[model samples]
Target: MKRHPRRSVPATLTALVLLAACALVAVVTIQMLLGETPWIRYDTVAAALHGTRWTDTVTAIVGAAAVLLGLILVLAAIIPGKPVVLPLRGDLDSGASRRSYRSTLRVAASAVDGVSDARVKLKPRTIAATVTTGRTTIDGLADAVRRSVEERLDQIDPAVRPTVRVKIRAVRKAS
Candidate 1:
């Protein structure tokens, strides 16, 4: 089954900060109800809020921070999540990782005659391969690699059929 890639860092940080703030408020409230010394005095808070310069500076900083945080949250909600796996033939959960697809394509391309090495890049809608060939004739090498890679892709039958692009590079002969 295709799973959405996780946005862990922001989510984790937000959760931790919220939990810490809640714990602090809870502790302070409990101390106040018990008539114990609070971590922060009410007078200090009143003074800070009543002061013109400090209050204005704090308000501006908080406003800017809130705006930035809102933008981040909006962006996180709007951006499309990337797929964790590419669906393949068979059971509903059957699929392949992108790395597996690239490896399969690279092996397939490298199997072509005269191909010394192969590098493959798999995208959502395209499969690109670069092959290094030996002294063999350059004619039809790219086509052969493309055909081989396409055949492999067809066998896998991924959710999206990617167009194949082959690039051939010849190895330099030793002097």
Candidate 2:
């Protein structure tokens, strides 16, 4: 019953940056071959490759740096760690909150006989939710969801009392 941890933003961003760098390098290489602007002077560079020139050395260093930077990015994404979880601020937590009570609540709701989607929102004094069940009545499915949620919460806090409201957002048409 292990829930998948969310992806890390930094890691994801690093991965995207790496991909962009690789793409940029590929595009630049293609442009160099095609005699495009900015990359229009490969012949001179190739000639420089034959000589012991400072420009050739600088170009080699820059290329190496770019490759090393890209490698570092790919490594960052592959490192093992839990996804970053930013805590809700005190102000936000005290207000009408919608934190998932537990994974079971979502799993249970999703498992309901006719529910296509079940999203539960917990507020100060009530639990407002929406369920998408093609063949299920909204009221009946909502009540079921509420009961399931309450039952799950009761295990932790027996005195937990919250009004439950269920709304049907959409029903998929059968083909």
Candidate 3:
């Protein structure tokens, strides 16, 4: 299953633009029907269109901007977003959200000895962990944390096993 987040921004902006355009037309139609002048007259717009030349810098700039905006909107609508939930192995019959998965790995790293704190960053195929210890000398803390994280990852049994990388940071001693 391909599960990814839907981009709401483009849809929202498009809806708002359509709504405004429709409202503007309705307002103008009502004014014209009432035998009064509209805020923006269609004849004025026609005159402006007739007066402007394609070679004019202002017209060229406006055309370029419109084209760029259209391309951006099309790309935004077509591009796939990052997956929010990663599927687990078949036997598990479940999925883990990015947040929950990262937290589980962080808990494993923090459970190790001399690990005061753990910060986990999840990428597509790598789980990078930074563990902070109170001790100034961290000889094998990074390896221990990596092993802890990897063991927990195995237990989770995700569909794709990301490599574990652990970085150890020690709290500075008081002067």
Give lDDT tens digits, candidate 1, residues 126-161: 888999988546889899999998899889998768
Worst 10 residues of 2 by lDDT: 89-98
**CA RMSD of each candidate after superposition:** 3.2, 13.0, 2.1
- Model 3, residue 100: distance off in Å is 1.1
Clashes of 3: 0
* lDDT, candidate 2, at 33: 75
| TM-score computed on alpha carbons, candidate 1 | 0.78
> Worst ten-residue run, lDDT, model 1?
48-57
Question: Which order, best to worst by lDDT?
Answer: 3, 1, 2
Task: Identify the runs in model 1 with alpha carbons over 4 angstroms from their true place.
Answer: 52-58, 89-94, 133-137, 173-175
CA lDDT scores, all candidates in order:
0.84, 0.61, 0.89
lDDT of 1 at 143: 92
Tens digit of lDDT per residue, candidate 2, span 1-175? Answer: 1122544676677779889988877887888678777543667767867775555768789889989977876666565443223133243422112334534456666676777887776554676667778872355766777677667656534233567676766575545
Which of the two, 2 or 3, has more lDDT?
3
Candidate 2 pairs with clashing backbones: none
Tell me the TM-score of model 2: 0.37
Q: Residue 133 lDDT in model 1?
A: 84
Candidate 2, lDDT over the whole model: 0.61
